[model samples]
Target: MTGKINSENGYVKVEIHKVFKVLLSILLCFPVIGMIVLILIDTKEFSPILIVVMLLQVLMIRYIFIGLAFKFLSKDSLNRLRDVLDIEWIKNQA
Candidate 1:
């Protein structure tokens, strides 16, 4: 889907692409799913310390992806993207 910005009644509306949304969702799920499968497949192979480390890693990855998703979907991010893209140029050309 195409991205668009609309301003009505002093509010700005931005439509983000579906592909990006889907990608973020996948990223958010991957680490948790991977860790779950790992634990299920070999609970005895990992020591307690190693399991703790792995859990920490999963949490860190999940946190990072969540932050990225929120940042990308935030209003400030949309405004920044618009500024970087120079929407006025496209408008002028049209």
Candidate 2:
């Protein structure tokens, strides 16, 4: 099947398995729990601060990984947008 995006089509087709989706949701809970812990605590200490920062770092890394994965997975849509814009630019130039 062609993964190319068309005007009639919305996005590139990328198959994400159900198992991975479930695992990803489970993994996301760690950060949420960490945030809840941080919110419940009242402290001016090093260890809790460190833990929160580490949790934030992990969440940020996860976010970046997901974003990059989606970008590469839906590249056909990006290419289609670029092509459409290029055509418009050429038409305007002429």
Q: Lowest-scoring 10 consecutive residues by lDDT in candidate 1?
A: 1-10
Extract clashing residue pairs from model 2: none
Look at candidate 1 and give me any clashing residue pairs.
none
Worst 10 residues of 2 by lDDT: 85-94
List model 2 lDDT by residue over 14-94, tens digit each. Answer: 555678778877776777676667667845443556666777767775778766786686666556755864532112122
- Alpha carbon lDDT of each predicted model: 0.61, 0.60
Q: Pick the candidate with the highest TM-score.
A: 1
Q: Give the C-alpha lDDT of model 2.
A: 0.60
| Candidate 1 structure quality by residue, lDDT tens digits, 43-90 | 888565765766776677666755666666675765676697666423
